[model samples]
Target: MPGGRPPSLRTVASWILTHPDALPEKERLKLKSVLAGCPELDALAEHVRSFGQMLTQLRGERLPEWIAAVRADDLPILHTFANGLERDLAAVTAGLSLPWSSGIVEDHVNRIKMIKRQIYGRAGFKLLRKRVLLAS
Candidate 1:
């Protein structure tokens, strides 16, 4: 916890969920003791684990129930996440259920943005279009 470069909250959560055993022995022991000492933390961990399982398994049908449970649990951060997910429920469900991903499309968009930045104030539309086509 006290280091020049400490791990992020997301990193710590990921470590706890995906690779706790890979953590250093002292850190792992501390994590285990902390979790064992807190019932709320244990329950939250179980909730997150179940959500992760649903995501990995592409069980979009379970999302509504999961959101409800999160809301009922009154975890402020998770409740905010649930609310955002609810706002984009359709897109979230599609992402969970579909085998396809938008990663390639997003990559292309990012490349285009990079190219635009590189050519900003130095190029016209036609030249930029040509560069984009050629690059692709």
Candidate 2:
């Protein structure tokens, strides 16, 4: 990232951004001359050219019309409920696989809760630690 060839997509995008005239005469001629001289920049220029064409096409189009077609029948009540529940379960399972699993860490919290219940207001920090480790 610091000292390497710029990524193809980003290089093309930045060139397009800075040079507002996508197919200006001077820029196009420079690209053509560079392409004639160097094969690698030629390939990059070709990609940038295609990307410019796509951007031009996108500028003239309207948003897709499919957004207005989703009715209640497209997503029933029960299916929507199940989809949300599935998302929650996937998030919880992903958290379990992280370097610090909340499940194991929650066990430590459960131990602290037990210690608090047993000690009430009397035990100091040292005795609480002794009780937790010995209990573990």
Candidate 3:
């Protein structure tokens, strides 16, 4: 086989979860071979897909169980992610369960920042606020 640096396990796992059908037949076969060669990668791919499905389906109630499973695994990276989630579990659960999103708020904040930068030295807060209101 032609050789350079091999694909990282994470990259392969992500591909398997998100875009398996997007791969060319040859590449798909290669990925299957690689996965079959590594049981850990296979298990990691399964967990990744499961978590993705949970998020997509807004299954926030299952987050605790999923976090526990991740903690039980030998994967340090996933354990760290689970720990961070535990620190703000309520917010995370709310985000998953609520239909509302912060996208609009974030967009407004970004626009205000852009306006501030454009008028940095030329305008004061009052003018900036006026322009932001008008732009919106």
Candidate 4:
């Protein structure tokens, strides 16, 4: 026998095999070091290492009701929810055309200062609004 020993490999195997949920990172590393004293954990270690990837793959699955609901397009009776969806879609798809999409109105607002200065600040809000609408 060796002059010094931690324990028989069987002892380390039993310690890990019996406490599946006790494997915190620190404890897990310690257990791994001890397990290196034997080959018993090879299969268990491989499976444990793959557990997170397995869970991630499972999580990628769409829930049945979620798929059905998306297909149905049914939503609560709230205009805000629909409006929010519209805004999100607008932000994503640059191809979306709406009253707000064109920059003509924005350009008109930015030009208002120069237009007002040219007019010596005599233009009122109504005149400015009319000029902006016509410019756009």
Residue 114 in candidate 1, Cα distance off native in Å: 1.0
Q: For model 4, what is the C-alpha lDDT against the true structure? A: 0.48
TM-score of each: 0.75, 0.30, 0.76, 0.23
Candidate 1, 1-136: lDDT as tens digits: 3344555667557656864556888767656665676667666776787788777888878889988888878578888988899998999988877788889999999999988998999979988898899999
Q: Rate the local accuracy (lDDT) of all candidates.
A: 0.78, 0.50, 0.81, 0.48
Model 3 stretches astray by more than 4 angstroms: 1-14, 17-27
| Clash totals, every prediction | 0, 0, 0, 0
lDDT of 4 by residue, 1-136 (tens): 2344455667655555544465566556656666575454553444333333333344313333332333344333323433554465434223332234458776766798666666666767888777757765
Q: Pick the winner on lDDT between candidates 1 and 2.
A: 1
What lDDT score is found at residue 93 in candidate 4? 29
Q: Which runs in model 2 stand beyond 4 Å of their true positions? A: 1-100
Q: What is the per-residue lDDT of model 2 for residues 85-135, given as tens digits with 9 covering 90 to 100?
A: 346654533442344436888989998889878987887888888888888
Q: Provide the lowest-lDDT 10-residue window in model 4.
A: 59-68
lDDT of 3 by residue, 1-136 (tens): 2365567867676577775667888778777777787777776777787788778788877889999887777888888888999999999988777778899999999999999999999978899989999998
Top-lDDT candidate index: 3
User: Candidate 1: worst 10 consecutive residues by lDDT?
Assistant: 1-10
Instruction: Return the candidate ranking by lDDT, descending.
Output: 3, 1, 2, 4
